[model samples]
Target chain A: MAANSRFAVAAHVLSLLHIHEGGRITSEYIAGSVNTNPVVVRRIMGMLNKAGLVQTSPGVAGATLARPIDEITLLDVYRAVQPEDGSLFAIHDNPNPDCRVGRNIQVTLDTAFTRAQQAMERELAGMTMEEVCLDIVNRP
Target chain B: MAANSRFAVAAHVLSLLHIHEGGRITSEYIAGSVNTNPVVVRRIMGMLNKAGLVQTSPGVAGATLARPIDEITLLDVYRAVQPEDGSLFAIHDNPNPDCRVGRNIQVTLDTAFTRAQQAMERELAGMTMEEVCLDIVNRP
Candidate 1:
């Protein structure tokens, strides 16, 4: 399966908005930096907008951060662009109920996978867009 | 993107081998419990074999774990079945070099993402197939 890059693109879009605060940053301009299509940037930006991370006027080329950079966690950005299900791992569907292991495996695996996913999310939650922007600015 | 169910299937397969220990657990039998095809079971078993997690004989219908269930962690099973790249998140490719954030974003995201992935892996590493088996056996 192809790796999902929506999280990465969303992060780039947000970083650009934060760094260029008070400026009109368009999808086309963000696309230039991401080296992808403006449509792709707009699509991700739409998710951010829906998540209330950014505000965009109808037919406008630019958007503004709805929350301060420090308040927006990477976890928030990840969830915004991720599918609504938002599970980091996928469980198989429909194991046979006749089999003991099959009957119980889903619940068993769910417990473990949830723990692992939460561990990752906790890390993302601890990190903010402010930290990301600071790292970008400090880069040589 | 479709949710990747390989991890769940692999865990289910391994649990069967453990629960039905001392029995010749064929791919067909495993498939019945997983509610998948024998071909799917064999394909995952092939990966486990290659990862040294299981031992399979040519033209054989069954296989055995390479180590005790207590010695095998979910992280081991996860890595065995995961794509070689194994990154949970993907970064956008080919950002413009002319853009400062673009040039630096990859590295910045890498550090943060790696931490999150490792956090999840560490959680997986802490939990063993033994724990999973116990959970399965204890289920009501």
Candidate 2:
């Protein structure tokens, strides 16, 4: 499977929103910054809205952060945009039951994968949209 | 993109090798246990070999661990199978530089992502093939 870029794209979207807070920026504009399509932005926006990270009003042309930029962590955005349970690792569902490794692979992998995911989330939780926006404005 | 299954697949290969050490196990057999293709298994094996985690010899139908399972960490398997610098997260190459957020996004993302990758590796480094194999055999 190809690597999913949703996390990067979603973080990009949030940073843009943080930089342009109080302004009505369309998904097309966000897509332009993200170098992707408005449809993709909208799909991600829909997920973000559902997760309450961002909100879209019926009359609004674009979305806005539901809370302050500093209040939203990358982990929040990650969870918002991620599909399913959003586990970064996946164990093959069916393995040869007769093989000892195959029979126990899922449980063993799941334990390790769960820990890796939590570790990743901890790292992400330390970063916020405000921090990203600040880094952009301060970049050399 | 779908989540990559290389970690689980590689670990599965390692465990099977551990359980049947000194015996030749074909890629076909490993694929059967993984429920993936022999080509997929071979591809992973190639990476493992390059990492010096596994050894392949002439006339041998299968590969074996280069080190004891207790000495091989999940981090080793992960590094073996990952492409490029093996960073778990990737920032898109082209973000709209005209936008403040876009201009600095990559650097900002790289910093966060690098930390996330380190955290994940730390978690993986704590586990070993021996532990995984034990989990398998102990399962009801």
Candidate 3:
């Protein structure tokens, strides 16, 4: 799950929180909604909370989006789950730099990945959980 | 892996093809550029070719971007590799559809995913393979 899917999970949780629209919800309930383990839900919440997207409380408490659902973008959720590892699309480790193409491929891939991620972020930037909530309401 | 990195691999390959600038390179070479196995490279290439993002040759052959890399965006590469399976984010399969929150989460997720992917494409629309290649040449 280290591959950046928490965005999906985070969005799901946030949508639920938005639906609740008032108070915190337990990880157990959220996990039930997700059909995943409570630990999984809590872990995702932890990540989201660390990124300032959500706030968590212990004991008789659960989690809530730090801001309005519409204020949160997919990118915000993504940043919360990203491991300290590196870029979203870093090149392979220790490429065969001996080869002419391999030697320089990193540079090219970096630029491409950068552009791709920028594109992704830009795309994500245009949206908020509010739009998603609207669609959910409109769904047949 | 059926995870996020797969897209990174596809983007890496397409970015390399764009850098090749229409030069015919074998899958082995593409894999080499990606630092992954050639078989895996060929497999992904086969998918890309099928998606019309690339053209491949049979028997000891390589692949080339079907569209100019500039005309292509990160979304194009992602589509070629993954075929837009389901949603961009994974939600629980057995959500409590009975509950208002669980019932509508999928629709919300879909809308969010669509907007996010579109924003990513629009941002990517600002770049071209030529810029990616030039960045490679200029990188320290």
Could you give candidate 3's per-residue lDDT for residues A61-119 as a string of tens digits?
65666887778877777677767553654456555565555566566666666765676
TM-score of 2: 0.90
Task: Give every candidate's TM-score on chain A.
Answer: 0.96, 0.87, 0.85
Most lDDT-accurate candidate: 1
lDDT tens string, model 2, B1-140?
Answer: 25678878999999999888888999999999998899998989988999999998755787988999999999999888878667677667688888877778888888888888898889999988899889888986
* lDDT of model 2, residue A11: 88
Worst 10 residues of 3 chain B by lDDT: B83-92
Tens digit of per-residue lDDT, candidate 2, span A1-140: 25567888888888878778888899899989988889988988888889899889865785878998899988898788777777778777689988778888998899988998899899989988788778778986
What does the lDDT read for residue A76 in candidate 1? Answer: 96
Per-residue error (Å), model 2, residue A3: 3.5
Fraction of native Cα-Cα interface contacts (under 8 Å, chains A and B) also present in model 1? 0.91
Residue A50's lDDT within candidate 2 is 93
Stretches > 4 Å off in candidate 1? none
Residue-wise lDDT of candidate 1 within B1-140, one digit each (tens)? 27789989999999999888888989999999999899999999999999998999979766888999999999999999996589989998999889999999999999999999999999999999999999988986
Clashing pairs in 2: none
